[model samples]
Target: MQGNFWPDHIRRLIEQIGMEHPIIQAPMAGGPSTAELVASVSNSGALGFLGVGYLTPEQIDLEIRKVKELTNRPFGVNLFVPEISEAAKPSDKVLNCLQEFSNELGIDPPQMPGPPKYSFEDQLSVIIDHKVPVFSFTFGIPDKALIRDLIERDVFVIGTATCVEEGVLLEEAGCSAIVAQGSEAGGHRGTFGSTEGTPMIGGLALVPQLVDKVEIPVIASGGIMDGRGIAASVALGASTVQMGTAFLCCEEAGVPGPWLDSLLSSKDISTVLTRAFSGKYARGIKNRFIDEMSLLEDEIPNYPLQNSLTRSLRNASKDKGDSDFMSLWAGQGAAMSRKLTAQELVDALVSETYQVLKSIGTNL
Candidate 1:
């Protein structure tokens, strides 16, 4: 066992989450994170995550049940904190523009989904009712009562932060740990309260700074693709590492073929942070839809609205086997992604980190 080899902090985090390794297969929501992938990674002794950000409460339960059926080991579920802020207000002009976009995609213009919106509160209740062992969230801080309830149930809670202050708030809100997500991270930017505060700090620079500022454990995220990255993060004071982009190419990832192909052929610096797809800043591959939407950036609605508006286009693109009009979310380190099964990837990560650490330790 590598028990004695782990640094004190990493060991503590591993014990905190009850994982055998300090690696966490990031919850790559919106389809890539499959139940099989989550189970395989957890079964490999690393924490697996189910990205429930886009799922309905019923869907969330079904996904959790599927993962439980596959593995008796501990795993986690990731959600987005619902933020009803004054970021963007709906306008008639915006609706017309969206209608035009719908016309271009040969789809019906969207109508308000109405009162019973997909409730985060509902999802949280499902997670609790099922006694989910680990829960994590991003976008904004979860309410205190929910945090307390999860703690009472012994759920190890994690929150995502794009900067030190965000991390501090999460720790203050009683998160078990904070995932310091740098600009290079894929999917949505987890910036909250102070959006400009942590616009785009790179992983190497962001992790250590947060570690210095916060008392809780910090997990490094963004552009991390291999064991070298993990070993480097530990040296930089990250207790563990959360990775998303690297796992997109794994066999069990529910990614479409065109999307997977782009990641497999991607190079460093190929991704950009854009809000054209989901109304919130997220890192993804540059594509036709992104380029076209860039011209209309100012009119983009707030996250929930914009995300709902474009859902059909992205979904249709996937069905048509086209990448040009799809949201190809990926991190900057996509070039380092390997085509392997989830278990193979986890094992490789562990072995590679062990070797890197061992070599460094010997030299020291």
Candidate 2:
């Protein structure tokens, strides 16, 4: 599409966010997300977000250094806000069950571990120290102190929200923009508070509704794989778009071979959302591991506990190139994804979007 197809607000938002293209590469924690991928996307005129959810402050700094070394293009970093509760802890029963799975996979299960804890404060400190151009987060909001600090550093903060209420909260907390993550998104849902039945909002419905609800620019995410999807999002009033699955198929995404192969093979019906991998709900291709976890859901521990317990098995599975135990995080748009370099993907998306817009103009 002609650049003017985008409104002044969208153009201003894109320029303010430091992206030549309105695409923002969604951060995929655990693996997949790498400095190479982030740098490539950013260099290709799109914004790349490095996933720092599971990394410590020091690690975050290291990755930021690596991204800077690879390219001087502005990129974003994503953090996971910590949420704690009694029920989220591991119970003896759950531990024993996890051990059983560990034995089956021939890997040692984790011993009794401490409660879930991560230095969100320290991570924020690193973000401030690095002075990244853009910051994005999911799971929940940070305190006012953290928010103020990020702003003081002149960091453009973006927060992910699954529902409109959460979007409003992000804006109230002084976010530069909001990522309207639909249920069709891969990886963990950014549902704040009680993880109720998040209205399974697809991009078509979610983007426009969220745009109408919030004045801040909305970056549409979930099940978006091509220029048609991007054009659709802009038509719905989104200033930009964020994508994870599309990048998963990129050369720079460091996922194991099985993961990429699965993405290539998956169809529309091959995916499901399960709390199997991490206790927290996420969407992925239905695999034997998830199927087994569904059968033993009641016995599984919460989040980090279960996540820790299965770490060895998951690692072993990846090493062996087995798809069964791999956490194949992918969205409904997986079927449309193509294996390409990150730069190529961004260029193709821009070209395709321009074509669609031109077609529409011709019709008019």
Candidate 3:
């Protein structure tokens, strides 16, 4: 708890990323990851991240400046790697299915969306231009030349992987670290290697496998909420832990009131993985929307397309303070969430990790 409790390599990794603790706040892109939350966590000695995957280049620039103003400590920015091809247009059935939900919410039905306002290259240019300290991405790996560019700029690049195969691919692409995201993770599944269904590996089983395969440091993620989880991750050969659900209810997170209420009342069995909200699969608390969409699982369109279609309905639901229609993305550990300040949560996690390690007679 006091001096260098982590292994030498982990200590070096921590220092290299300018973090005092081996915790990295997961980048919850849509809304939960606020500037205040990111800064508060970084200020608490843990690395915080801004989920800028949905932001425009200009918006990303502004967000980086805001976090810098709040805290000088190092933090990270996460982007979503663009899919190789455009999503096929949805059929009438899929459109009608979404229309029913819009009618129920008394909002206008969604229309097909145009191309993304900005490209990944546009976003990456902004990140590089600002010289962000840590750059992490999900969904898939970036080009080798781009990865080289980031490393040359001294940006610590991190990539997310749901299985060992993906982790090995990331390492081969020159990632500085890899986040071994498990099936228990909340947001979009980062399973890109598979040609079939999404990978369903749990953190306990996935972390060590990825560590053994990849030479780069593996950061354990998924269902990791407390100090016990952190201790377990370290024991599994992880260099650090990336937690999202644990910080969703933090005061500084600025999550919508309805979503906050849902998390506070959730139980272990409340969450389900579905592509109801977005075409891509993600985990969130079960709701009428998800339940209804499950019946038409096969009819749903792929990501970005479905995501664009539902944007208005989601925004309307948020404005009306209705959780029933919200995405409500959360991990399996949502039941263990705590309503605390970011700093308080980080402090408690560090203290708890120290005690857990000490109690188990692990050498410091």
- The candidate scoring highest on lDDT is 3
lDDT, model 1, position 220 = 93
lDDT of 2 by residue, 1-364 (tens): 4545567878999888778889999988887889999999999999988998888777888999999999898998898888774555566766676677677778888665655455888887787788788988998999867787788778988998888878888889988899999988988888884346645777788788889988889999999999998888888899999999999989999889999999999999888988888777889999988987786777676665677667777888898889988889999999998999999999999999878867777331
lDDT of 3: 0.92
lDDT tens per residue, model 3, 72-100 = 99999999999875559887887898898
After superposition, the stretches of candidate 3 with alpha carbons farther than 4 Å from their true spots are none
Model 1 agreement with the true structure over 180-289: per-residue lDDT tens digits: 99888988889886756436888889999999999889999998889899989988899999999988999998999889988988888778888888788998998887
Task: Report the Cα lDDT for residue 286, model 3.
Answer: 94
Residue 74 CA error for candidate 2 (Å)? 0.8
Residue pairs clashing, model 3: none
Angstrom error at residue 322, model 1:
0.4
RMSD of each: 1.9, 2.0, 1.0
Per-candidate count of clashing residue pairs (backbone under 3 Å): 0, 1, 0
- Estimate the overall C-alpha local distance difference test score of candidate 1: 0.86
Name model 1 segments beyond 4 Å from true.
86-101, 195-198, 362-364
lDDT of 2 at 101: 66
- Highest TM-score: which candidate? 3
